[model samples]
Target: MSTRGGGPDRRGVRAKVEAQRAAERRAERRRRVLLAAGAVVVVGGIVAVIVVNFPSSSSSSGLGPEGMALQTGPQLASVSSAASGQTVDGISCDSSEQVAYHIHSHLAVYVNGQQHSIPYGVGVVEPVPSTVNGGTFVSASQCYYWLHTHAQDGIIHVESPSQKQYTLGQFFDIWKQPLSTGQVGPASGHVTAYVNGKAFTGDPRTITLQPHEDIQLDVGTPVVPPQSVDWSHAQL
Candidate 1:
């Protein structure tokens, strides 16, 4: 009887040991599963961030109204001013599919083809300084942000293919110039220009332009004299 009772107690102890071992195995598996899941989530989050900031070829940010227009022929530059005594429509910006306004470093703001009141000299965009120093870097997407520091006089200017142009002081009117997509030539994007006090104008200097394109003002010589070829019936 003592041996039989001892046998039953021994069996119970063995069974308890087996149960503990089984429970520990299950706990380990659960820990491993949780770790794997955590790693997957971390990797997935990183991929999502890369997709958001840098879109793949499958994505596009969509073009503005000017960008959507069908371009036909050589491009010319456009200009507008609040004090020019001409309304936005006078510059054909109201119904123009190519109207672009430069307000500071921002472009594509007025792509709606509607003439909006913009403060003159209040906000203007300029080209990178490297371009003026015989650099071939054209202002991207019709607008640009330029960086330059001068101890003495610093001014921004605009010149069109027709040799029409304007000069802007640091605290003066905002200058806007439209670039035509129609023009076909080098120096097409920007006329080689430099900064000077004298305003420039003359015969229609050849410049390359695309439909609905505009370049902001910067300190550079108006390589193209910026004069209107046909002011009476001109679409300048």
Candidate 2:
């Protein structure tokens, strides 16, 4: 009788020990799970902060008006002062468009790897009629400047009374914007210019507006390659 009772008591003690060990294992697993979840939350919060502060080029944080992608549509309106028929950089704003020295050049601008639109009617007078073309603004003004743009298609129309040399600096002058080695309009950075898909090492202001010339200016990092426009379908 004594031996049977002792055996039963030992069995009960063993069972209790086993149960205690199982409980301890479960508590350890729960602690591990809690730690892992906390780690994930911390990591997620860090990622969100980085995304908001340093948005990538593909991010919509830097989009232009109407949710337009940077450099893909009209970024700026025609300078208001330009409509006053004031002579800028020796270029004249006449009552009518000149055709004697009519020619076209393309100017593409990029700031921090994002393209910006050169906008229609850059040198045209106010109250200009505009239409949307492929999400871009196209304008036709009765009064015109020697250097004017009819569309936000990056085409610069050089229409003068006579055929003479015109520089990119003169165009910015008409646009009433600052241009230099460290800035392009309102964008400030190290200016890198390209002419006809070739890197230009000289002052961007000195860049001549040749017929059908492809001029590109990049400000800041992640420099984009010069883009070419097909002139076959473009009516100057």
Candidate 3:
């Protein structure tokens, strides 16, 4: 009789132990869920940190083969001429003692139909002083790249490497200014680009820099006769 009476009690204790084990399992699952959520949050925070520390679109840029998203911004250094001397990216610059090449091109920039003067010594590391009413675009400097301006007349002197295609956007990039369809440095308006007096339907960055080729960019209304370079008067 006593043994039979104790059997029910034993069964009740076994059921209680089983219920405790089930509750423990549920609690463990909840802990795992919380841990997984925490890991995701931590990982997300780390990614955000990395992105902010990396370079922005306004700096550190390169043009693709098709001139896609060509960043017309400042460079990491002065093309690092000090480190590499007269050659970079397998391209050579003017000699340390004298100008090696003197190929010239014409460039015209207008904002609201008003012409903007290209500054002299724009790409030079040691810039020459500019005088009022007249500015030398390409001021003599130690490390002269092929792309430079000698005066505000908008003539681009490819005085470094020879027989290499340069782009108009690269000139702006070296000038440390923004160039886009909607903006050119501080001038902001509708931009229209022309290559050799013909309307450029492609990205402005694709304008191939060529000798005596007139590249005009108007930001605002189009001027009559098109603001092209005066080939007859261009100081080639």
* Candidate that would win on lDDT: 2
Candidate 1 ranges beyond 4 A from true positions:
1-6, 57-211, 214-236
Per-residue lDDT for 225 in model 3? 46
For residues 176-210, write the lDDT of model 2, one tens digit per residue: 88889998888899999999999999899999999
Best by TM-score: 2
User: Candidate 1 — number of clashing residue pairs?
Assistant: 33
Q: 129 in model 2: Cα distance from truth in Å?
A: 1.8
* TM-score, every prediction: 0.32, 0.65, 0.53
Per-residue lDDT for 89-143 in model 3, tens only?
Answer: 3444444423455567666777776667554454555655444222223355566
Error of 1 at 106 (Å): 17
Give me the runs in candidate 2 sitting further than 4 Å from their true place.
Answer: 1-78, 81-83, 132-142
Q: Could you tell me the TM-score of candidate 2?
A: 0.65
Model 1, CA-based lDDT: 0.29
